[model samples]
Target: MATPPSLSPISPPSPPNTTTTAPPSSLPNNTAPPTPPVTNNSDPVADSPNGTFANLLPPPPPPRSVESLPPGTLAGLIVGVGLGALIVLIGAGIFVIFYRRRKKKLANNYSGAAPQGVDPQHWQQSVPQITVLPKPTPPPGITPHLYNSVEPPSTSTSLGSEKPSNASPSPVVAMGHSLGTFTYEDLAMATDNFTDSNLIGQGGFGYVHKGVLKDGKVVAIKQLKVGSGQGEREFQAEVDIISRVHHRHLVSLVGYCIVGVQRLLVYDFVPNDTLEFHLHGKDRPVMNWSTRMKIALGAAKGLAYLHEDCKPKIIHRDIKAANILLDESFEARLADFGLAKYSLDTDTHVSTRVMGTFGYMAPEYASSGKLTEKSDVFSFGVVLLEMITGYRPVDKIQRSLMIA
Candidate 1:
């Protein structure tokens, strides 16, 4: 009977996985609400609408457009992006500039010692301590003027008697001549390579030439060729001796040029020729009596300047008519200092090698070579005689010496 009940009461099982939802547990009480009464006033469709007609109330004003946001939003976003990129670029640029400046500054920095606060471009000179030296001392025979220059006394070296007498001459050249300097190129260009056409005169030590400078300034150039004639030291001596000597009657050395082996002296060019040309040339006028007297006085003044005014008495051993240069105004000047001899080196006369022209030399200097201030006086007398008589000293001496 049980078996038969199972078969009879069996129903198909629910599908395997399907789920069904149940209503809420809190169910409302079983009560009926009264329906509202519908009053018939006019056609329903005309009075009020429902369903699709009610839904068509302009579709709820079509939802607002998202792109129509407030004014600042999109602009703010774009500016923010641009500002961010600018900040990144600026940061990178600043970093690069800092590194480059630091690198360049370090590269330019120098560690070597230099003068304090000196720019190295201006006052950059430095005086190192170790480079200083003691002043030099003079050796024997260097101070030749203190005693006889040629023959030192037998006891002089042994005794070393350094004391001097009261009447010692100063070493200074006295009132000094105003001197000028010229560029070496000026002389070369002026003389046109020391041409023969420009040659005006010649001497034992040098040659003279007339020249015109680039500025149209006329000048005379005395080229001193390099040799051991007076020795290389003579060139320096000539400049030193002449620079310190000044007299109205003496020719003024205006400028000089020295380039290696070439040495040139510059003088104010005299427009007129030498006195010898006028005295000897037939075409030229003979010098007047007053002119000759002035010339003699000028020569005496030049000699007086050399002998009395200067510290060391200088004797122009070769004074002659050829050496007397004249200007356009006939003003006289004593020229040719290349053969000048000086003495009174110490407290007394310091004699060395005896040298002079034949006719103008003193009798004492010519024979024994023992010269003094008196020797120059004798030579001056000879020149005076020559000027007064208008006769050459050589001719007179030749005539007199042949008398025996």
Candidate 2:
């Protein structure tokens, strides 16, 4: 009770007039501590006093790696993509083009042959074996019957009374052979209106006129006489036979023409003239033995080709000196296929009307019209005799002394 003031102070006051604030832990157990305000370091706007504007704004994007990329990178990427697409398109286009071309080539190859199980005659009429070029529109009444095999002359129909309407259409350009087609006006212009001044020679079929073509080619244009049935038959036979066979010693057909009733044929111009002209002309030097033998051999080779080499062996019913044409080099070119006939491999001989030059006819052919390769051999022998003796086949004074 009687303690000193220095030793024992008041319990709540360390000294007189001190502060009364208490620490948080010294607070009563029933009272809770107050919460402190939060501060954001990452977002300065959110850390600011005005938090309403910070809530409305979107967060800033991450920093772009612009320095990591090379220059022109975007443009190069676009160009690379475009080039890749272009290369793919070009490759596809090339494939399509090659496919079409190969298909066309195969089709063309297949078209040139006869199909299995098909009739040969029907196939011949429909599709020929030769390659045909692009053809222009044909004239009226002209059918697609070019290269049709000629009917044998066994029919009793007279050649003198036949009309043009009854005859088959002559070979047009690009039909069954490689031949040019010309209009009547074009040929007339080429031959200077087909004047008699341009006439080079005449034959049983027509008159030949030497002319310059539009291409500056010198050709012999054969103008057949109109309204002659024999002429029409000759035209058909020549076109059918000559267009197929090809030999160095055979005349080449350049082209043909048909306008109204007019019929014309074009052939390569043989500059030297006919063998008949050289052998029997009015005033000409005699041909040497070597030259005559050479001509004879060449003519023989041509005849052999017609007889043995041709598919359906051709029999030149009129193989004579007048039909053998000579070129600049004296090479023989067998011309005038008007009277040619086809002898099948199965048949022994082709029998028909007796027609040919008188002296050159074989005895069997002249008597019974039984034409054969032997007949040609006989005629060839007669021609050889003429060559040896320098005498015409039917000499006026030597009628009784026949060599063949």
Candidate 3:
């Protein structure tokens, strides 16, 4: 075999000269010295005993490809995944907490406080607690009595002979349930003998006066005009309808009085005046768009409750602007249920005498005396027109008149 040529040792090339600078006195001299750079003579082929050309080049740059990750890289990936999972878990926990709190608040609003004077034992007993009605579902298995042919209770039995002036009038139990009752004396005293200053409003049937009961509760006392022809029927009808139904949008019946021939209805006093007053009263500030929209929505909801929720749905025979009263918060409530009539599920239209404000009556109801939920809708439309145009239903000056 021929002898291989001897390889000569190679010298490293000199580095280019750079100006050296001294550290400033303010800096410390504990810094480590710079590392010397490897030269061509430092090849693995020259250093190793079994050297080959394969070892001459650098050791393949320690495999920088993704497949060969560094030790620290794997640790960093695991730490990053753990941190992301922790963040997601924390976010989920926060969302669940907020949702539960909001749900509880809504439940409280829908379930209002029990009415004053409700017997605790009776409230806790089998009688189901009255909550804001979401829809009118009749009491389970209970037949709703129709008032279509209900005649006025005879004078002898209706209000019963007036109790002697010396004796306190006995409380009258409601037909289906126990409700508060007032004597003529009790209400007369509350209203200061129905002075003109106590009068809040007047309607075809009666005058409404603000009164304060002995229990410190404010009430609206509606004294029906004697011999109004329908006073007796209206009293019974209103009691039957409002006693069994409870809704946030409807005026709550506090109690009723039938002393001798005088008839009166007590209701929870709504602090604000009628929608008519705000909409048409002179020198009153214009109702803003938001407030007007709120009123409209609330009134629609009230009618919806009567038409869609009640078992034998009710048709608000009178849905004029005057009947829509507002509370201190400007919440709209449907008042005056004296003319409200029930429409049985089996009946297409209740055959009743036409009764409503002059210009707010529906044409079909006025001409045919046929009553249905549509009758109320027609009146509601007229009220909506009034709200939009800011005009009375019967504006004699404008020559604008709307019936039903």
Candidate 4:
């Protein structure tokens, strides 16, 4: 061999096997850690004491149910639910009680019940009076008391005696004497289909048409304006109030017709026109002083009757020359009860909506809606100024007739 390099390669000697002991500080003091047992890849058995996984997982948690709840917790939940139900029931009961009380109070107010501190007996015994200046001498042939001779019709011929009609009676009839009820068709025929030719007047509430009924009785039919915000209730209230009142100086309600939303009131027709026509109309003779005084007195008497004679006093809210209707004999008749209001005898002032002609309205009533009998009296005084001065209460140059 050593004679020539051997063609075969020789492997390097492997390092001699060496064993070195670790330092005491670096080595663990206890015995060597035990090796973990290897799990068999193909084994289906569970590694549990009883050869099942049930023990490995905590014994399956107890089934979830309300029964698992603690005794005190269950009782508290029941008590909470009961308390909530009780509270709801109590609130509903209180609401119903308050609602009933408020409704009853409103009804009493609307029905004009006697107010607190008012003695009904004492009020009945007393005669209410409207203070007035002494009256001037009346013109010849005209009686001093214009309406004294006129008597209310007997009960036999009153509205209560009217035969029942096909149309149902309005609730307004119950408040006063029963009134005749007419269908819309009956009224249409009487007024020739509400033609302009038959139109007698127009005002805030509606148009007035002259008509002749089948019974040959002449009447003034008032057709309330559509979309005027006036409804069956308001119309019924007006009819109820006016029907109960009967006076020679006051307009009378003959009957009323209701068709759907349409409301028509029938009244006895006055032969002559309104007092405004005679006082301020063109081509009219000027009213003399004595005639003016007579008119003033008559109107005052009517107002006084409304304010004093009525059980629940009526306030003629709108008082103006235009509202005064004249008869053939020039006797004054107060018409248009649309804006009338009822006032309690014990009330100092009735709070209401500010209504009435501009110049005729009292300053106190116009500024504040507190109305009283005195408010009507103030309007009457304005009318007196109009009669005396022969000028309009409100005019282009003078907005209001100021007292000197």
| Model number with the top TM-score | 2
Put down candidate 2 lDDT per residue, 163-217, tens digits, no spaces.
Answer: 1133454333223444566776677888898799999998667799999998899
For model 1, the local distance difference test gives 0.58
Q: What is the per-residue lDDT of model 4 for residues 123-187, given as tens digits with 9 covering 90 to 100?
A: 21111112222333332333443111011222221123221122333322232234566766788
What RMSD, rounded to one decimal, does every model reach? 25.8, 16.0, 24.0, 22.2
In model 1, the clashing pairs are 145-345, 145-346, 146-346
lDDT of 1 by residue, 274-359 (tens): 76676665677666789888877777777777676554466666666777788877777887676565555453553545776677
State residue 275's C-alpha deviation in candidate 2, in Å. 0.8
Model 1, C-alpha of 141: deviation from truth (Å): 40
Name the Cα RMSD for model 4: 22.2
Please give, for residues 20-61, the per-residue lDDT of candidate 3 as tens digits: 565455634676655555555665666566877655566665
- Provide the lDDT at 118 for model 1: 26
User: Best-fitting candidate, measured by lDDT?
Assistant: 2
lDDT over C-alpha atoms for residue 254 of model 4: 84
